[model samples]
Target: MYAYDTITEAVSDLKKRGYTKDFNIRENRLACDQLDTHFGHEDFEIIEVYRFEGPSDPADEAIVYAIEAPSGALGILVNGYGMYADENNSEFLQQLHERVRLKS
Candidate 1:
């Protein structure tokens, strides 16, 4: 795994590594409008997780996830964590996190 100084740095490097799509966190799935596709928890796996902490403000906290779908689609999911996180997306992502943990 690589250490990234910022979310932009991690995303840029991952894109270079072929995680080229952008995924949006939906209520129940990850959506990529560019591909006109959406994925459920079973459809994709989290390849990498990079978390960032704010120096002074909690709102700056974020996580960048490298995700790959079973169909070979590669993408990135950038989300804010903690109290400010979206309820639906947070629950959705937590299930994914658990899956990855169990797989490891």
Candidate 2:
């Protein structure tokens, strides 16, 4: 898991990579919202954003987002992630990977 100095930096990196605030906010809210949700306000403590090579499917070749909810210590997975390589997805990811801390 990667760590960000600030959530804003993470969000900015995502935005630069063609992700919008609406998308992130929506995903976060959906994953962490709702009183009885698995990732409610009492689960985990970290919200992580990263990318993986994905499986053999086209849809599978996407970025993956994982959030540590604040409720049940659950690790919520948000799939179907995308980014604009022309922008700075790689750079951002590299920087984040190099700069941000990680959970053991």
Candidate 3:
């Protein structure tokens, strides 16, 4: 899990890495354009873009993404959710790494 000071920072980092702003409609939903120009790009098929939601705590809620690798492995996670200091950051990167390192 990447610790970001704010959601914008995370979004910016992804955008810089070739992720484009694809869509935004729902209050908590944001869709990013595909990273691949053609089929079978990175073995990791980027899926839906989502923002986290909770009943009471907005901070607890985080933005999430769904990713699927070419090998049929599935994981729904990203690099922007967790605690800033140390004790709260979720292992989102670990989840992402699991999918990213798949054998395409």
**Top lDDT: which candidate number?**
1
Q: Which digits, one per residue and each the tens of the lDDT, describe model 1 over residues 1-104?
A: 89999888999999999999999978778899978989888788888989899998989898898988777889998888876788877777788778767866
Which pairs clash in the backbone of model 3?
1-93, 52-62, 83-88, 83-89
Once fitted onto the true fold, the runs of candidate 3 whose alpha carbons sit more than 4 angstroms away are: 23-44, 47-60, 66-104
The local lDDT score (0 to 100) that residue 33 gets in candidate 3 is: 34
- Between candidates 1 and 2, the one scoring higher on lDDT is 1
- lDDT of the candidates, in the order given: 0.86, 0.40, 0.43
Per-residue C-alpha lDDT of model 2 across residues 1-104, encoded as one tens digit per residue: 44445344545565565433232223223333333443322234435555544345444433434444433333333334344332323443343334325642
Candidate 2: residue pairs that collide = 42-70, 42-71, 43-70, 43-71, 43-72, 43-73, 44-69, 44-70
Q: State in Å the error of residue 75, model 3.
A: 16
RMSD of 2: 12.8
lDDT: worst 10-residue window of model 3: 23-32
lDDT-better candidate, 1 vs 3: 1
Off by over 4 Å in 1: none
Ranking of predictions according to TM-score = 1, 2, 3
